[model samples]
Target: MALVASLCNRVIVMYAGRIVEQGPTRAIFKNPQHPYTWSLLRSMPRMDEVGKERLVSIRGVPPDLGKLPTGCKFHPRCRFKVDRCLTEEPPLGEVDPEQLARCWVLMKNVSNPEMQS
Candidate 1:
């Protein structure tokens, strides 16, 4: 991510052979709307934290590629899992001119306060 942030103009986030989000690097880093993006950022070591601090990590195991789950592949590990997430695969929808995201809840309301929703 640090490398991508420094060198790439755009970013594409993929999970389970599917694209979760794509946008200008600054836009995606500054305002990540998807649950996967939120979790990923949270799992990184904070620059503001003092030395010897613990780094956060994403929970749950990565899904098997060959035998993937139905619907939204990320649903099983996502804290924001909803009923729709289990059965309905969300399409990549434009969040802005350059940003796109794939998540039923985020598609409904990217501005949702609780990222865990």
Candidate 2:
């Protein structure tokens, strides 16, 4: 994904009618902290020969934005959901010098630090 993004010189990630995360491909992929992006990265199957587990999937389909659910629309499918997610819309937050992620956990500084470089 980062390579694809790098070729374009720009990166944009969308979910549930919103740009959940966006930034330089290297920065975004190397430090993916958004739940949506994390899910995307985790969904990739391992290429090595070993006991690699099957890829994980993001549950449920995206909500119909025409009649989008009230408040945090992703609550139903987000594995890292919290009580705040049920009633509040999360704003995009600066996760690093050049990246932004829209997630309540990230917005409130509640998420774990991104995986080590």
Candidate 3:
């Protein structure tokens, strides 16, 4: 991920063989729109931390690709999942001028306490 952050100009986050989020590397890292992307960023170790901070782990295991979930493949494990997410797969929509995400609950609409720092 450090290598990706340093060497890539763009990033495309995928889940269940589908693109969940895509954008400029900095934009995606600084402000992820999809819940999966947010969870992934949270799980990474930060170099600037002062103490031995435990990384956050995304709960639940990945769904079987052969027998994928009904709606969003990530809904079963997503903390920010809504009723719509369970029944309807969100399209890859524009999050900003340079970002696109596939999620019913965009991170911008939610108050993520972790991102406060």
lDDT of 1: 0.82
> TM-score, each model?
0.85, 0.78, 0.92
lDDT per model, in order? 0.82, 0.71, 0.91
In model 3, where do residues sit more than 4 Å from their true spots? Answer: 50-52, 113-117
Q: Report how far off residue 86 is in candidate 1 (Å).
A: 0.3
lDDT score, residue 37, model 2? 78
> In what order do the candidates fall by TM-score, top score first?
3, 1, 2
Choose 2 or 3, whichever is better by lDDT.
Answer: 3
Check candidate 1 and list the clashing pairs.
Answer: none
| Candidate 3: pairs in clash | none
Residue-by-residue lDDT tens digits, candidate 1, 46-69: 667857665556678999999899
Candidate 2 lDDT over residue span 1-117, tens digit each:
635854865577788878888887876666676777777877776567246566678788878779886656777887777888888888887877778888876523444423311
Q: Report lDDT (Cα) of residue 112, candidate 1.
A: 45
- Lowest-sum lDDT 10-residue window in model 3: 108-117
Clashes of 1: 0
Best of the candidates, lDDT: 3
